[model samples]
Target: MRDALVKYGFIAVTVVLFVFFAATEPAFAQSSTMFSMLKFASVTAILGLGVTFTMVVGGLDLSIGATAGLAVQLAAMTMVFYNLTGPTAVAAVLLGGVLVGLANAVLIVVFKIPDLLATLGMMFVIQGAKLIPVSGQSVSSGMVLRDGSVAPGRFTPDFLLIDRGFVGPVPLPVVIMLVLVVVSWFVLSRTSAGRILYAIGANPEAARLAGVRVGLYRGLAYVISGLFASVGGLILVSRIGQGDVNAGASSLLEAVAVALVGTSVLGLARPNAWGTLLGALLVAIVLTGLTMKGFQYYHQDTAKGFVLIVALLFSFTLSRRKVRYTPAT
Candidate 1:
């Protein structure tokens, strides 16, 4: 009974919550509302995937949100300031993500800094550095530049399609999120490299002794994380059609919370892509339901925190009992 509860309880609770919201709020039952919730979850889930990759390597990345914010700024600058095309903006942000990830690898793997501290420092650096080009102003169409000239470009229609266009009946962002989650799940759960990564996470020294390139794989994890963050940022830029200086400010907390909550999902007790998606869904439901129920914006955070705590408690406290078995004599 305990094991069954540990495995299925979270899913059951989520379903119950969904049903409750649908029953009470007439608007929540609408198809548009459902898609809107999924679209919101898509970005959060992508950011969570970034954190998940690092977590699998037994490391934490505090810089994911800042890296994403930098992507947002870079994409906007590419299109709105440099008068470049959407593809150029996409390429710019992806390159920026890789560079940030590489720098993190250098700091942590080569320079021997603690992962948390290194990423935390990087977060601050990125947050500050992204503001330098525009003199701390948000980037948008027709914004005045430093030399008293208005920016000549705006977000191209092609770029806006990334977030706005629908494939059949599904939103593009949601489809992207689903594809990423599926790919990530396959890579982490079905491949030899994935096994090696888990082995390293379990015991780095042991994995090193077993002929695994511990440092290399760990570095790769950070790079993947950075790439995911950049993608999330690009999606955000497409959605908003401009770069807000405050973009990605809330991403860190939301992503971290999603990742943490994912660990215990389905009793897996590990960071996983499916679990991350589920966690994102749970959070989206809570926040959207509260909004429809007339709850204040500030109270939404508290509700999210509460759900995370409960999920974790079930994962850690209730699922840790030992099962004793006698070996054949």
Candidate 2:
């Protein structure tokens, strides 16, 4: 019973939170509120999914938030400055993200920089670089450019449809996030590629000796992470109809928090798309419910931090107990 509780505790907590919020705030039970939670959770889930790819390979993607920010600026700038259409803008930004991933790969794989340090350094570089293109200004329609003239282009309605338009009463972001989660889960759990990644994560040296291309697999993890982050950025900009330079910091912190908490989800004890999505939903529910209750935004991070710590402790304790209980060989 204790083991079961430890293993499934996060799910129980999420259910309790939902029930408590519904009971305390009658409106929280409404379909509108549920949809709102799903919409917001979609972005965090996307980011967490990106981070999960890296984590599965015993790596980290600290630059996800900055990568998202860079993507937003690039996507927005392409449409507004280059007179590019929706698809062109998206393609440009996604390629930019892929480049960022390649850069991280070169730094970590080639130079042998530690994962955390490599990504952390990249986070700062990308964050600063994003601001330079816009002259430290936010990207909005008809905004004044560095040359002192108002920009003419606007975010096309077609592009906006990616996040705003609904398909059969479902939010677009929610739909996209869900579909990507299922696809990613299948790739990670049901394919030979997944087996190789797990083997590399388990022991990179052994995997390489066993004929696995460690550098290629490891670098691809960052590439996947970058692409996912770019998608999140696209959704973010589309939802707001503008690109805000300062958007990346909060996203980075929250997404990382959610991903770390996912490590212990359902006793997986490792990164998984399903776990990341659930963790994101939990974070979103807590924040949304609290905000509806009139809680200040500043205090919400504290609650989120507490929840993460509890999840970590829950997983750590169980792993230790299991190790201690194993009989002598």
Best by TM-score: 1
Residues 227-303 of candidate 2: C-alpha lDDT, one tens digit per residue: 99999999998987887888767888778777778777777677788888888999888998899999999988898
Q: Model 1: which residue pairs collide?
A: none
Q: Tens-digit lDDT track for model 1 on 162-263? A: 899899999999999999999999999999998887777777888999999988988898898899999999999899889988899889989988988888
Poorest lDDT segment (10 consecutive residues) of candidate 2: 320-329
Error of 1 at 298 (Å): 1.2
Error of 1 at 135 (Å): 0.7
Every candidate's lDDT: 0.89, 0.84
Instruction: Report the error of model 1 at residue 323, Å.
Output: 16
